[model samples]
Target: MPVVFFAEGSAAMGPEARAVVARAAERARAWPGVPVVVRGLAATDGSAGFGRALSEARARNVADALVAAGVSPDRIRVQPRGPVPYEAMQVESRRVEIAIGG
Candidate 1:
């Protein structure tokens, strides 16, 4: 499970996120013909609509980053998940998880 953490209300990828994306892309390149599924998740902040939009945007941002890192666009699938309540470490909820599969 490759995860990228994001700041509150932000879709931009920081240094750490970039590093993670780079690593994922490298792995993707290593395993030829495998499709990678990147799911973006965001914490609920009262509004479901807003949360969904944010999550989608975050997911797309990560997908774009991965593509820019040399991963084939066709090999990446972006799935944005709606806000999920987090009782502990809510900040950790603001993230995108990348899973590589065939």
Candidate 2:
């Protein structure tokens, strides 16, 4: 899994996130027949609805990046995992995990 962090309350991709997406896209392109799962996650902040929407947006952003990088859209699945556990750390909690073989 290749992980990329997001801002606390935003889905905008920064340079680091874009780099991660590029790496993941490369892996997906390597194994063209494999499925790519983009799991979007949020920190334990704000309301549940807020987290859900944020995660969804983040997942879509990553998925869009993958397709732009030449990964097939059909091979990508966006899984909005919503909020992380309340005890999860800030840096690690707000992220999306790109799983190339699930």
Estimate every model's Cα lDDT from 0 to 1: 0.86, 0.90
* Model 1 spans > 4 angstroms off: 86-89
Give the best candidate by TM-score: 2
How good is model 2 by TM-score? 0.93
Query: Quick one: best lDDT, which candidate?
Result: 2
lDDT: worst 10-residue window of model 1: 82-91
All candidates' TM-scores? 0.91, 0.93
RMSD of 1: 1.5
Per-residue lDDT tens digits for candidate 1, residues 30-96, read 9879999989888875787877888899989989998898889999898988677755447887999
Q: Which regions of candidate 2 fall more than 4 Å away from where they truly are?
A: 85-87
Instruction: After the best TM-score superposition of candidate 1, give how far the Cα of residue 90 lies from its true spot, in angstroms.
Output: 1.2
